[model samples]
Target: MEIHPLHPTFGAEITGVDIGRPIDDDTFARIRQAFEEHALLLFRDQDLDDEKQVAFSERFGPLEKTFSQNPAGGTLFARQSNLDIKTGETIPIEDARMVYQRANMLWHTDSSFKRVPSLCSLLSARIVPPEGGNTDFADMRAAYDALPDATRQRLEGLAAEHSIAHSRAQVDPNLLSDYQKSIEAPPVKQLMVRANPVTGRKALFIGAHCSHVVGWPEEEGKRFVRHLMETAITPDICYSHQWREGDIVVWDNRSVLHKATPYDSKKYKRLMQRTTVAGDQPTVMQ
Candidate 1:
């Protein structure tokens, strides 16, 4: 298989291998290495149903099930769609589903609110709209590298709190009720910086889910988080993918931040299936 880099620092396209079918160990090893080295890898011209997608994703590791808050709760798939799963029609723009989707537009790491953050995620583009809805990723490794010396030093030995409710609140304050916010494992702590075990690269770990530093006052911590977010999402470190049908993209959650772009949900049909690889260990202490 040939791997072509999409950006100077992060993403790559993998060709000459069909992920829909079973892959041999040697080839899968190369793919794994590329995933660690590139952080994001895209495979195009591949169609996958639920069975196939699950089978392919299993090759990476065990997958995380959708939480109660998701439409596909208890399933391995985190369904991203404008249509109701049962009705198969467009959901109204004012619906809670639309509001939930809007939160994705803000940059965040997948599953960071969990006690154990995700290792990586596989997103399959089952349906595509006529326009918009691109997925953007920022390379946090490069972001960490670009930080000023003092900022980097300040980030050392610090930990920040993360919660799904905090991120959803950015779009709408009442997005999740108090009970929804009280779900098991809703809040977790992550280090201010992360280091990749396989690649030996350090990265800025701050994102939308992070609400505050552990010891600092709330406002002071949030201000620093916001400042770090700005530094991590600079133009040179970001890459936006305009997806096409039959595309499967996998990204390492540890060293990257991603966001969803807007599409006319009322006018167009868009469906994506995501399977998140469960982290083998926690990124921070409980």
Candidate 2:
């Protein structure tokens, strides 16, 4: 198999490997190594069904079950589609379902509010619209490396509050239903810097899920978080992926932040399934 760099800093495209079939141990090892070094791996043109997607994702670790708020709850898959699940028809722009999807456009890591955050996420493209609907990823490792010495030193040992409701509230305060709010993950404290166990690389962990710094004044904390976000998304630190049918994208949630872009769901259909690999252990604070 040949691996090609998709971006100067972070992503790689693996060609000549079909994930639908079983892979040997040595091949899987190389893939894992590439993942650690690149932070994102894309395998194109592999027709992955739910079963195949689960099998490939399991190679990384045990999968995370969808939460109560997800339409695919009780399963390992988190469904993303514009069609109404029961009717299989295009949902109107004003529908609550569409509003629910708007929250995804915000930059954030998957499952960051959990006590044990996600290790990585794998998303498979089942159907693609004619235009738009791309996924953009920011390399946190690069962001951390670019910080001034004083800023980097100050970031160490810092902790921030993270919550599911906090991120969703960015799009609309009432987007989450009252019952859904009851089921939301309570705010959890997480270090601003995380060290990758396998690579020993440090990355900034701040994102939309971050409500504020644990001990700082509330307004100051928001400004700090916003500044870090703005700095991290500078052009050289990001890579945007345009989905094609049968593309399986795996991104390390520990090392990158991602957001979805707009698509004309009113005119066309789009479907994507995601499987998250649970972080067996909590992040190591720097």
Candidate 3:
């Protein structure tokens, strides 16, 4: 397979291989190395079914079950779409159910609120919208590298807390029920500076799910998190992906943050399916 870099630090497009078929040890190793070097890899024109998707995902690790709040909860797939699968009808944008998905438009690292978080996410584009509905990814490694020396030094030993509730509150506060709010999302003490175990390169770990620093005042913590997010998502450090049918993208959840863009839910049908791989271990405080 030939690998072509999409940017200086972020994505790569792989050709000359089909992921639907079984892969040998050497091929899998090469793909793993490519993923370590590039935070995102796009594989186009692969017609993969549920079994094939699971098989390919298993090459990396065990898959994470869908979130309890999602329609496909308890299954391996997280379905992202405005249209109802059974009826094939578009869901109203103002509908309470549709509004719940608005939170995804905000930047986030997948499964960050979980104890172990996620190692990576594999997303396949089954139905592409005629317009809009693009996904944008930011390279956190570049963001960390661009920080001033003093700022980097200050963030070295610090940790930030992340939660789904915090992100939900930001996008649609009215949708959260009392029971949902009561579901405690345990805080993970992730270092502000994240170094790739294989590459030895560092990246910032802060994102929208990140609520605050452990010991700081709430306002100060929010400000710090906001600053890091703003710096990390600058246009130059990001790559926006326009989806096409049969396209599959795999992203390193530990080193990158991604967000969905707006689309005409009333006019177009867009379906994106995602599967997340569980992290090797839970996040621990130092």
Which candidate, 1 or 3, has the higher TM-score? 1
- Judge candidate 1 at residue 236 and give its lDDT: 94
Encode model 2's per-residue lDDT on 1-286: one tens digit a residue. 9999999999999999999999999999999999999999999999889999999999999999876666566689888888777888887887766776787898999988887899999999998998999999999999999999998998998998888788889877887666655555677778899888889999999888888888899999988998888776788999999999999999999989999999988888999999999998765342
Q: Pick the candidate with the highest lDDT.
A: 1
The window of 10 residues in a row where model 1 has the poorest summed lDDT is 177-186
Question: In candidate 1, what are the lDDT values of residues 81-129, reduced to their tens digit?
Answer: 8989899999898888778878889999889998888989999999999
Collision count of model 2: 0
lDDT of each: 0.90, 0.88, 0.85
RMSD of 3: 1.5
TM-score, every prediction: 0.98, 0.95, 0.95
CA lDDT for candidate 2: 0.88
Top-scoring candidate (TM-score): 1
